[model samples]
Target: MLTIEDCIALSGLNEAEIEAISEHEHIPEIVAVEYGNYLMHSPDGVPMLKRIILDDIAAAEQRNDLKHALHLRLVLRHFIRTHRDLHKVAN
Candidate 1:
Protein backbone atom coordinates (compact mmCIF):
# COMPACT_ATOMS: atom_id res chain seq x y z
CA MET A 1 0.00 0.00 0.00
CA LEU A 2 1.16 3.51 -0.66
CA THR A 3 2.09 5.50 2.41
CA ILE A 4 1.21 9.11 3.09
CA GLU A 5 4.75 10.04 2.14
CA ASP A 6 4.30 8.29 -1.18
CA CYS A 7 1.09 10.13 -1.78
CA ILE A 8 2.73 13.43 -0.93
CA ALA A 9 5.53 12.61 -3.33
CA LEU A 10 3.05 12.06 -6.14
CA SER A 11 1.62 15.53 -5.67
CA GLY A 12 3.38 18.66 -6.94
CA LEU A 13 3.45 20.29 -3.53
CA ASN A 14 5.99 19.61 -0.79
CA GLU A 15 5.22 18.23 2.64
CA ALA A 16 5.04 21.65 4.28
CA GLU A 17 2.59 22.90 1.68
CA ILE A 18 0.45 19.80 2.20
CA GLU A 19 0.56 20.36 5.95
CA ALA A 20 -0.50 23.97 5.58
CA ILE A 21 -3.47 22.88 3.50
CA SER A 22 -4.34 20.29 6.12
CA GLU A 23 -4.13 22.89 8.85
CA HIS A 24 -6.18 25.41 6.91
CA GLU A 25 -8.83 22.94 5.78
CA HIS A 26 -8.83 20.86 8.97
CA ILE A 27 -8.12 17.69 7.01
CA PRO A 28 -5.63 14.89 7.33
CA GLU A 29 -2.33 14.93 5.42
CA ILE A 30 -3.44 12.30 2.92
CA VAL A 31 -6.58 14.21 2.17
CA ALA A 32 -4.68 17.45 1.94
CA VAL A 33 -2.40 15.90 -0.65
CA GLU A 34 -5.36 15.15 -2.86
CA TYR A 35 -6.96 18.50 -2.20
CA GLY A 36 -3.76 20.37 -2.91
CA ASN A 37 -3.39 18.54 -6.20
CA TYR A 38 -6.89 19.47 -7.16
CA LEU A 39 -6.36 23.09 -6.20
CA MET A 40 -3.17 23.33 -8.20
CA HIS A 41 -4.95 22.40 -11.42
CA SER A 42 -7.97 24.68 -11.14
CA PRO A 43 -7.90 28.31 -12.31
CA ASP A 44 -8.97 29.91 -9.02
CA GLY A 45 -7.03 27.38 -7.00
CA VAL A 46 -3.78 29.32 -6.69
CA PRO A 47 -5.40 32.27 -5.00
CA MET A 48 -7.30 29.92 -2.73
CA LEU A 49 -4.11 28.20 -1.73
CA LYS A 50 -2.48 31.59 -1.20
CA ARG A 51 -5.35 32.60 0.99
CA ILE A 52 -4.96 29.44 3.00
CA ILE A 53 -1.24 30.03 3.53
CA LEU A 54 -1.81 33.69 4.35
CA ASP A 55 -4.44 32.72 6.86
CA ASP A 56 -2.01 30.29 8.42
CA ILE A 57 0.64 33.00 8.62
CA ALA A 58 -1.84 35.37 10.23
CA ALA A 59 -2.85 32.77 12.77
CA ALA A 60 0.75 32.07 13.65
CA GLU A 61 1.42 35.79 14.03
CA GLN A 62 -1.70 36.21 16.12
CA ARG A 63 -0.34 33.65 18.53
CA ASN A 64 3.06 35.35 18.50
CA ASP A 65 4.76 32.45 16.80
CA LEU A 66 7.04 34.50 14.62
CA LYS A 67 9.12 31.50 13.70
CA HIS A 68 6.14 29.65 12.35
CA ALA A 69 4.90 32.77 10.65
CA LEU A 70 8.22 33.16 8.93
CA HIS A 71 8.23 29.54 7.90
CA LEU A 72 4.80 29.95 6.40
CA ARG A 73 6.09 32.91 4.46
CA LEU A 74 8.75 30.69 3.00
CA VAL A 75 6.12 28.12 2.20
CA LEU A 76 4.11 30.83 0.50
CA ARG A 77 7.10 31.85 -1.55
CA HIS A 78 7.83 28.30 -2.58
CA PHE A 79 4.22 27.68 -3.41
CA ILE A 80 4.14 30.73 -5.64
CA ARG A 81 7.46 29.86 -7.18
CA THR A 82 6.44 26.28 -7.83
CA HIS A 83 3.19 27.17 -9.52
CA ARG A 84 4.77 29.69 -11.85
CA ASP A 85 2.16 29.40 -14.59
CA LEU A 86 -0.61 30.13 -12.13
CA HIS A 87 1.39 32.93 -10.49
CA LYS A 88 -0.57 35.59 -12.37
CA VAL A 89 -3.63 35.05 -10.19
CA ALA A 90 -3.16 38.54 -8.74
CA ASN A 91 -2.77 38.09 -5.01
Candidate 2:
Protein backbone atom coordinates (compact mmCIF):
# COMPACT_ATOMS: atom_id res chain seq x y z
CA MET A 1 0.00 0.00 0.00
CA LEU A 2 1.19 3.49 -0.78
CA THR A 3 1.81 5.73 2.19
CA ILE A 4 0.57 9.33 2.24
CA GLU A 5 4.16 10.58 2.18
CA ASP A 6 4.95 8.36 -0.76
CA CYS A 7 1.90 9.50 -2.65
CA ILE A 8 2.65 13.10 -1.82
CA ALA A 9 6.22 12.73 -3.00
CA LEU A 10 5.12 11.17 -6.23
CA SER A 11 2.26 13.51 -6.94
CA GLY A 12 4.40 16.66 -7.20
CA LEU A 13 1.91 18.44 -4.99
CA ASN A 14 3.10 20.57 -2.12
CA GLU A 15 2.00 20.32 1.48
CA ALA A 16 -0.16 23.41 1.25
CA GLU A 17 -1.88 22.08 -1.85
CA ILE A 18 -2.74 18.84 -0.14
CA GLU A 19 -3.86 20.66 2.99
CA ALA A 20 -6.07 22.94 0.94
CA ILE A 21 -7.65 19.95 -0.75
CA SER A 22 -8.29 18.33 2.58
CA GLU A 23 -9.77 21.48 4.07
CA HIS A 24 -11.93 22.43 1.09
CA GLU A 25 -13.21 18.93 0.43
CA HIS A 26 -13.48 17.84 4.09
CA ILE A 27 -11.30 14.86 3.31
CA PRO A 28 -8.51 13.36 5.36
CA GLU A 29 -4.88 13.72 4.45
CA ILE A 30 -4.53 10.09 3.39
CA VAL A 31 -7.56 10.36 1.13
CA ALA A 32 -6.21 13.62 -0.17
CA VAL A 33 -3.00 11.83 -0.99
CA GLU A 34 -4.87 9.27 -3.01
CA TYR A 35 -6.84 11.99 -4.72
CA GLY A 36 -3.61 13.83 -5.44
CA ASN A 37 -2.12 10.71 -6.95
CA TYR A 38 -5.20 10.21 -9.05
CA LEU A 39 -5.02 13.80 -10.17
CA MET A 40 -1.40 13.46 -11.15
CA HIS A 41 -1.98 10.26 -13.08
CA SER A 42 -5.35 10.73 -14.72
CA PRO A 43 -5.50 12.20 -18.20
CA ASP A 44 -7.99 14.88 -17.19
CA GLY A 45 -7.11 15.39 -13.56
CA VAL A 46 -4.60 18.22 -13.71
CA PRO A 47 -7.01 20.84 -14.89
CA MET A 48 -9.53 19.58 -12.41
CA LEU A 49 -7.01 19.92 -9.62
CA LYS A 50 -6.23 23.42 -10.81
CA ARG A 51 -9.90 24.30 -10.68
CA ILE A 52 -10.18 22.88 -7.20
CA ILE A 53 -7.22 24.86 -6.02
CA LEU A 54 -8.60 28.02 -7.58
CA ASP A 55 -11.87 27.44 -5.82
CA ASP A 56 -10.07 26.94 -2.55
CA ILE A 57 -8.21 30.20 -3.08
CA ALA A 58 -11.48 32.00 -3.68
CA ALA A 59 -12.97 30.48 -0.57
CA ALA A 60 -9.96 31.53 1.43
CA GLU A 61 -10.32 35.04 0.07
CA GLN A 62 -13.94 35.10 1.14
CA ARG A 63 -12.95 34.10 4.66
CA ASN A 64 -10.17 36.71 4.70
CA ASP A 65 -7.58 34.03 5.07
CA LEU A 66 -4.97 35.87 3.08
CA LYS A 67 -2.17 33.54 4.08
CA HIS A 68 -4.05 30.47 2.94
CA ALA A 69 -5.17 32.17 -0.21
CA LEU A 70 -1.60 33.17 -1.05
CA HIS A 71 -0.40 29.68 -0.31
CA LEU A 72 -3.03 28.16 -2.62
CA ARG A 73 -2.10 30.57 -5.37
CA LEU A 74 1.52 29.59 -5.00
CA VAL A 75 0.63 25.94 -5.16
CA LEU A 76 -1.40 26.52 -8.31
CA ARG A 77 1.48 28.46 -9.86
CA HIS A 78 3.85 25.60 -9.12
CA PHE A 79 1.39 23.12 -10.53
CA ILE A 80 1.19 25.16 -13.69
CA ARG A 81 4.96 25.33 -13.95
CA THR A 82 5.38 21.58 -13.53
CA HIS A 83 2.41 20.66 -15.66
CA ARG A 84 2.39 23.47 -18.17
CA ASP A 85 0.72 21.47 -20.92
CA LEU A 86 -2.04 20.40 -18.57
CA HIS A 87 -3.16 23.99 -18.14
CA LYS A 88 -2.62 25.19 -21.69
CA VAL A 89 -5.98 26.89 -21.93
CA ALA A 90 -7.52 29.06 -19.25
CA ASN A 91 -10.75 27.94 -17.66
Candidate 3:
Protein backbone atom coordinates (compact mmCIF):
# COMPACT_ATOMS: atom_id res chain seq x y z
CA MET A 1 0.00 0.00 0.00
CA LEU A 2 1.22 3.49 -0.75
CA THR A 3 1.68 5.98 2.01
CA ILE A 4 0.03 9.39 1.99
CA GLU A 5 3.38 10.95 1.20
CA ASP A 6 3.69 8.67 -1.80
CA CYS A 7 0.29 9.71 -3.01
CA ILE A 8 1.21 13.35 -2.59
CA ALA A 9 4.43 12.90 -4.51
CA LEU A 10 2.56 11.36 -7.44
CA SER A 11 -0.21 13.93 -7.39
CA GLY A 12 1.90 16.62 -9.07
CA LEU A 13 1.06 19.08 -6.30
CA ASN A 14 3.08 20.23 -3.35
CA GLU A 15 2.03 19.58 0.21
CA ALA A 16 0.82 23.16 0.70
CA GLU A 17 -1.44 23.06 -2.33
CA ILE A 18 -2.90 19.72 -1.31
CA GLU A 19 -3.52 21.04 2.20
CA ALA A 20 -5.36 24.03 0.78
CA ILE A 21 -7.65 21.73 -1.17
CA SER A 22 -8.28 19.66 1.92
CA GLU A 23 -9.09 22.77 3.93
CA HIS A 24 -11.47 24.15 1.36
CA GLU A 25 -13.17 20.84 0.61
CA HIS A 26 -13.34 19.54 4.19
CA ILE A 27 -11.59 16.37 3.11
CA PRO A 28 -8.65 14.46 4.48
CA GLU A 29 -5.19 15.12 3.03
CA ILE A 30 -5.08 11.72 1.36
CA VAL A 31 -8.41 12.33 -0.27
CA ALA A 32 -7.27 15.80 -1.24
CA VAL A 33 -4.35 14.29 -3.09
CA GLU A 34 -6.63 12.28 -5.34
CA TYR A 35 -9.15 15.06 -5.72
CA GLY A 36 -6.51 17.65 -6.45
CA ASN A 37 -4.88 15.40 -9.00
CA TYR A 38 -8.20 15.00 -10.75
CA LEU A 39 -8.69 18.74 -10.73
CA MET A 40 -5.28 19.37 -12.16
CA HIS A 41 -6.20 17.41 -15.26
CA SER A 42 -9.61 18.98 -15.71
CA PRO A 43 -9.96 22.23 -17.63
CA ASP A 44 -12.32 23.81 -15.11
CA GLY A 45 -10.46 22.36 -12.18
CA VAL A 46 -7.39 24.58 -12.39
CA PRO A 47 -9.35 27.77 -11.86
CA MET A 48 -11.37 26.11 -9.17
CA LEU A 49 -8.20 25.12 -7.38
CA LYS A 50 -6.98 28.71 -7.50
CA ARG A 51 -10.26 29.92 -6.01
CA ILE A 52 -10.05 27.29 -3.27
CA ILE A 53 -6.59 28.47 -2.29
CA LEU A 54 -7.79 32.06 -2.20
CA ASP A 55 -10.67 31.06 0.03
CA ASP A 56 -8.30 29.29 2.39
CA ILE A 57 -6.15 32.41 2.58
CA ALA A 58 -9.21 34.49 3.41
CA ALA A 59 -10.27 32.04 6.07
CA ALA A 60 -6.83 32.14 7.62
CA GLU A 61 -6.93 35.93 7.75
CA GLN A 62 -10.43 35.88 9.19
CA ARG A 63 -9.19 33.72 12.04
CA ASN A 64 -6.27 36.11 12.61
CA ASP A 65 -3.70 33.48 11.75
CA LEU A 66 -1.36 35.82 9.98
CA LYS A 67 1.45 33.31 9.73
CA HIS A 68 -0.69 30.69 8.08
CA ALA A 69 -2.29 33.34 5.87
CA LEU A 70 1.12 34.43 4.69
CA HIS A 71 2.15 30.85 4.04
CA LEU A 72 -0.95 30.21 1.99
CA ARG A 73 -0.30 33.41 0.04
CA LEU A 74 3.13 32.14 -0.86
CA VAL A 75 1.66 28.85 -1.91
CA LEU A 76 -0.86 30.71 -4.04
CA ARG A 77 1.87 32.77 -5.62
CA HIS A 78 3.83 29.66 -6.45
CA PHE A 79 0.70 27.99 -7.71
CA ILE A 80 -0.02 30.85 -10.10
CA ARG A 81 3.55 30.91 -11.32
CA THR A 82 3.44 27.22 -12.13
CA HIS A 83 0.04 27.13 -13.78
CA ARG A 84 0.09 28.62 -17.27
CA ASP A 85 -3.71 28.64 -17.46
CA LEU A 86 -3.78 30.99 -14.49
CA HIS A 87 -1.48 33.39 -16.27
CA LYS A 88 -3.86 33.52 -19.18
CA VAL A 89 -6.67 34.15 -16.77
CA ALA A 90 -4.68 36.95 -15.18
CA ASN A 91 -3.86 38.65 -18.49
Writing each residue's lDDT as its tens digit, candidate 1 over 1-91 gives 9988888888878999999999999998889999998987787888999999999999999999999999999999998888877778645
Better lDDT candidate (2, 3): 3
For all predicted structures, in order, the TM-scores are 0.89, 0.82, 0.87
Q: Rank order by lDDT, top first?
A: 1, 3, 2
Candidate 3: where is the Cα deviation over 4 Å? 85-91
Looking at model 3, the pairs that clash are none
Among the numbered candidates, top TM-score falls to 1
List the pairs of residues colliding in candidate 1: none
Q: Could you tell me which 10 consecutive residues in candidate 3 have the lowest summed lDDT?
A: 82-91
The whole-model C-alpha lDDT of candidate 1 against the native structure comes to: 0.91
Clash pairs detected, candidate 2: none
Alpha carbon lDDT of each predicted model: 0.91, 0.81, 0.89
Indicate which candidate wins on lDDT.
1
